[model samples]
Target: MDIDLTRTDIIKIVQYAVGGRVSLIGVNLSGLDLSKLKLSSVDFSFACLKNVIFSRANLCHSKFQEVDAENTIFHDATVSE
Candidate 1:
């Protein structure tokens, strides 16, 4: 299911993720402003993240395997090996 999520929906999901209430897996977030958002441990596998801004976002331990990250900005975003 390719659901086009709005910015508000993204924020809500992030909020829930912060509280360990939900997980964003395989969600298509193409062309979204995700800057400064804390998204630690979120799963982005096979997700469309083209042109998305993840600058300064806490993405430690997040999964981006097989994701379409074309033109995606991850300036200063944290990631673990």
Candidate 2:
């Protein structure tokens, strides 16, 4: 609940997740502003994305496998597949 992450550093998280063959599994990303980021193909299974803003972000082919997407904003975000 107190995860302090910056936009620049978030790619590290994503890379770590993917590198480890895991991604956003049950992560509490509440109130995060992930807008206009290159987050394509990242897995979000069982993650908590409450109130997260992903506006205009490139989420193409990213997995929302089992997420708590409460109030998550994907406005204008590329979310194909």
Candidate 3:
């Protein structure tokens, strides 16, 4: 299910989908301005984040396996195990 979502909408959706078990495989959020997001426990395998701005975003416990984040900016982003 591909949805045309704004930056704010993406933030809300990510928040809601992180409650427990959420699989976000093959999601294409390329070129989106997700600079103010706090994502956790979400599986973003094979997702396209090309040219996406993730400044100051909290991406704890999020899986980025096999994802293409080319040209993505992670300025001030806190990534951990």
Highest-lDDT candidate: 1
lDDT of 1 at 2: 52
Query: Candidate 2: which stretches are off by over 4 Å?
Result: 4-6, 15-22
What digit string (tens of lDDT, one per residue) describes model 2 on residues 12-58?
77666644443566767788899988888777788888899999998
Among all windows of ten consecutive residues in candidate 1, which has the lowest summed lDDT? 16-25
Tell me, by TM-score, which candidate is best. Answer: 1
Question: How high is the CA lDDT of each candidate model?
Answer: 0.80, 0.79, 0.78
Question: Which residue pairs collide in model 3, if any?
Answer: none
Q: Each model's TM-score?
A: 0.83, 0.80, 0.81
- Over 1-81, each residue of candidate 1 has an lDDT whose tens digit, in order, gives 354786689778877664553456577888899899877877888888988999998888788888989999999988785
RMSD of each: 2.5, 2.7, 2.8
Output the better candidate (2/3) by lDDT: 2
> Per-residue error at 58 for model 2, in Å?
0.5
Full-model lDDT, candidate 3: 0.78
Per-model tally of clashing residue pairs: 0, 0, 0
